[model samples]
Target chain A: MGRQYEIPIGAQHISLLEPLHFKFTTENEKIVATEANVYYVHRGIEQACCSKFKFRQVSFVVGRVCGLCSISHTTAYSQVAEKLLKIEIPLRAKYLRMLVIELDRIHSHLLCLSHVAENSGFEALFMKTMQYREFSMELLEAVCGNRIQYDFSIVGGVARDLKPQVAQSILERLKKFIPQLDELMDIYKNNWTLSLKNKGAGAITKEDAMRLNVVGPFARAAGLAIDVRNETEDLLPWKQVGFEMITETSGDVYARNMVRLRELYVSIRIIENIINGLPESALITETKAFPDGEATVRLEAPRGELFYYAKGNKTQILERLKIKAPTFSNVAAMAEAFTGNEYGSAPAIIASYDPCLSCTAR
Target chain B: MNKVMTSIENLKKDIGDFYKPELHHFMVMNAVEVGDQIEVQWFFSDYAHPCDTTCFYTLVRPETEIPSIKDIVASAWVAEAELVDLMNIKVENTQKGFVLEPDFESGPLRKKK
Candidate 1:
């Protein structure tokens, strides 16, 4: 119905609270192309890591890289330094690490689901998601002492040990969340407007997804069955704690939503299993320091694959520290996926990826 | 073979045949007064693949003759240029002098004397 139009959205807006801007070039209401302005608030975390902190101090610094995936950043840093130091963490420590990471996944995904419901004008559904999210958040606060940025990881092992009472409390809360999530899932699946808005709105083929190398929920939505946690078996010891990697062949906004929701259940199950067989040992491993060498570690963050590379010269200070976050890698694909989609669905489609721009920028 | 031996052997095999040919690609590589210079490691990536970590040593100061790896890895182009600009590492036959920002003299990472 139209030839050309310019739709300019902000680095900040009412619905999309994060500092990210998108300018859509459109024909009628269907977006033909899009462009983005990134690094507007680039805190220069990498540069700061290289210059400001000594080796030990960098862990605490990078943990503040992204609030939502603080564990992922810290875990990646710790794991890389562990390789450099040539020290193997204790068995109990490894399981605890997995438990905390699964908890982070649950914590992040619930917030994303609620945001989606809120954006779609489903007030009741949004409230339910928020209510369910509180249980996870409360458990996190009880375990790690802070709900938002849990500085629970140190160089060799975890910062805090899980007391029996705390573990039991978390277990009970997770038990309460399972049936509530299932009920919410039924409502989302049946909602006509929600399905219509999400389904096939931002579809990308499997081949394109592979070429773009989308990871996490976005990759799963494209039917790629790759999960770093499953691949790294020594990290997770439990047997019956099962999680089927959820995927949707449609590769649309709806598929992404489905993948995230299903993953929520898997994360809760993983936590339950960890508590059932909590290991016995000291939480912190003996630390020497990072040696004169370079180490790189890859971990599956809630968004996608996170890579942390560190170079140490056997000194207290690190020579180089580089972080490659998921959003940076997926930026191109996001632009491609949004093309030809209706401009009205732009906010919802972008929100479907549940982007944490802080993670991307840092 | 034993577990340790097998891991060592796997690593040796992973280094591949080009270990000798590609040895001369590093320059101005060493830790600055960080105890002893135990080893210098190299993180190499081919035109199409991800970077693979390798090692260079003090005994054989890797050939500093060749240009930096800007052609092979696109991302490292800016990084290497910045390194040269800041650290004053004289990379021979290097094209395009500065990467971070020209006229920005004095290194930010160096310890104040």
Candidate 2:
């Protein structure tokens, strides 16, 4: 009297952004089970890296771990290397790192929201969000010399300091995004169609969410109250600045959207704080020599927590670099969250978690 | 405690025989180089599996030989292989049995190379 069903989302499809196979076992339109077949896009990134590159050079290399999270990758990597070397970067350098990383978070979250809008057939919102994103992208290019791959963080410090004029100009640009983000959030909240589509979709209980160790905005939306920045005292310059961790008890698509929108403002405030109270000191180290040791470093990326372990043998080449990116752990939670969601709402629900397959596959 | 060591030692003792052999205690681990020797410290807890730290006692093996802990830990096998691949350190008797083959011409991080 028992029967089972299996349907495969094959890897060969043009719409599939990365090479991954999902075997969805379903009963009618309800997903009963999901089996993920990854490793298709596994490029042996961990296998390929070794002592051949200097700590500074490795920043650019690991920055490719995910375009959406390049800042997080480089920041974590640099922090680990700096810890190993026992070097305290100038206070200005730390603030600069905070500034750039938070900006990256803003761009990443907006991009995710825009993609969510696009998936939900809200074309106008998508176009408008993209137009707003251009300003942030341009700001990144103006400051760090590249749009996506910002080769900013060096082992001891940043490659360059934010010039006063550049900082002022960037502040003006950030001000322009505030009203726009507010308008977008208002639309998401008030739009009947969007609300009906997103509300109560892919909801998870707070207990279940905590038991699964779900992180980033998803867990917060469910009231887990975990943020790498807030959890670790050593992690932030929080006392000098102010921002609240946004939470929503619903834990649905709507909750996730609100948390992310609030995070955009939080990121902007953090950047503003860094610029205003920036310590006057050197940004880059005078010596390029690295120390012989190993260190584990963790940082709050736009998505969630990222960790890196590095070893150096007192040479230009690093002894080893092993990283654990957020997408790796978040994907499992995504699969779990996907259950009971309508098939038609799958793309938007998936986008709600902001899947960066490159981060996962890399 | 002695009980922890006895349990770990029961698995393997040779420094080069187990495959990515790790013991999780629910905390974190970092490898620190002190003078001429390497010291790997485990920051562990009694809870939180998969994501938390485990107390790992390992030996460098030329081939895979680490015993199965699937009953205890869910994703230890793949995680071990990842560590071996990234660090070029070996663990013996793993699920894969053999680590990635050393077909690449150069060892980028090893000083002897």
Candidate 3:
């Protein structure tokens, strides 16, 4: 402990989208330990869900948990509610849900990659990634009528159906976007400056990740083959839509970026498959049942596994609603990643985790 | 989903026996208040087959201090601290004020008046 001191990084920082406070204890410019405070954005959504909102209305309310992964929140909440209601959605509705989820995954990954680039001091790459990310946003707007916080998912099924022309347009846009993604992947992989900055800055080994209960791209990047989409087949037919889990063994910032980029391709492929094999059915089912039991739902959000627990007592209002966001689970791993790294690279390491404080604090 | 009801004293032993890091990934630890008791659920899953979930729940008095599983599953500290802040459930060897600011009171997830 020779001349040890503490440096604080944002409750509001340029690299962070939401408020997250980190106090890094450093000695000779290397981090020895870290303390994180992520409660700045807590809005009591869990209590509000049980006390304020009805079962049918909770899906839309939970969608406000995080703007980027709002689809994941809505999907997780709807699945839990649907389980309690015992509603089996139609094939067409399932396909539409999968389509929008894949779209959301693509945009969310691109946003994260761009943020990582910006934090790593590659401003040009950040701008380029943002430019390519616009295509996914435009496609989402065309389908869901809004860029962010799209309330396309309802309890029994989806709120809107995708038109034939909209599907065709999505296919065309994805076709045009693949080449751009390939070029971006090339740059991400081969850029010497980026590789130097991110290659091993926040590396966490497989054992540490497992012990820390890491999820999603971070876990997958560390060689963990855990994906909720691969596990939960009853919710959606991800296999039928050509969903494949992408993994990297490095468990570093570069590895995380590679995993996200590759998953973007996987999401695009799933969207294309859904468009090609889309079935025709009712957008939403007519169900007059009320929830009277408890159900737990877990889904793979862009960052990681988003979990929701809902309990009802044969009434319109729920008894309790519990949400454990991926970032909430990854908090320990995030703190661990800060250790054994230089203080200067903290922003890039934090950005590589792609934390959603609003989701975590909710 | 498999549900196992255990007592507060046997929670650590039961969870220690059930949680195999290679086979099960710790999902989350959740606590809900029921009348005079607080129902705590520890969720774990087989990542290879995620549909298979093992849930271990224990009901305790609101003031009872639950043993922390941070020694077994290191990441559980976050969840343990969260329960302390949100549900007002006391847990041993865990920090408070994770989701609530230091100046604010705890138990935001509890029933309101």
State the lDDT of candidate 2 residue by residue for A1-362, as single tens digits.
Answer: 22556778746543345555667777777776776655555555553456445566778888888888898888888888777777777777778888888889888988888877776768798898888888888888878889999978877889976888889988999898889988998988888888776898878777656545566887788976666676444534654666567788999988988999988898888888788888898887656566577656657788876767777778777766767676655555666776876666666776787766667657
Candidate 1 has a DockQ of 0.07
List TM-score per model, in order: 0.78, 0.81, 0.98
Evaluated against the true structure, the overall lDDT of model 3 is 0.90
Write one digit per residue (lDDT tens) for candidate 3, span A1-362.
57998999998888777799899999989999999887798888888888888888899999999999998899888889999888898889888888899999999999999999999999999999999999999999999999998998999999887988999999999999999999999999999999988998899989888888899899999998888889888898898889898999989999999999999989988999999999988888779999978899888899999888888888999988889899998999999988999998999998999999999988
lDDT score for candidate 1 against the true structure:
0.66
Judge candidate 1 at residue A349 and give its lDDT: 78
lDDT score of residue B104 within candidate 1? 52
lDDT for position A251 in model 2: 95
List, residue by residue over B59-86, the lDDT tens digit for candidate 3: 8998889999988888898888888988
lDDT of 1 by residue, A107-218 (tens): 7887887877767666687788888888777777887889888887777888888889998888878777778888888877778978877778888887666555566788
**Sort by DockQ, best first: what order?**
3, 2, 1
Winner on lDDT (2 vs 3): 3
Every candidate's DockQ is 0.07, 0.12, 0.81
Among all windows of 10 consecutive residues in model 3 chain A, the one with the lowest summed lDDT is A11-20
Model 2 reaches what TM-score against the true structure? 0.81
Interface RMSD, prediction 2: 7.9
lDDT of 1 at A83: 75
Clashing pairs in 1: A11-A20
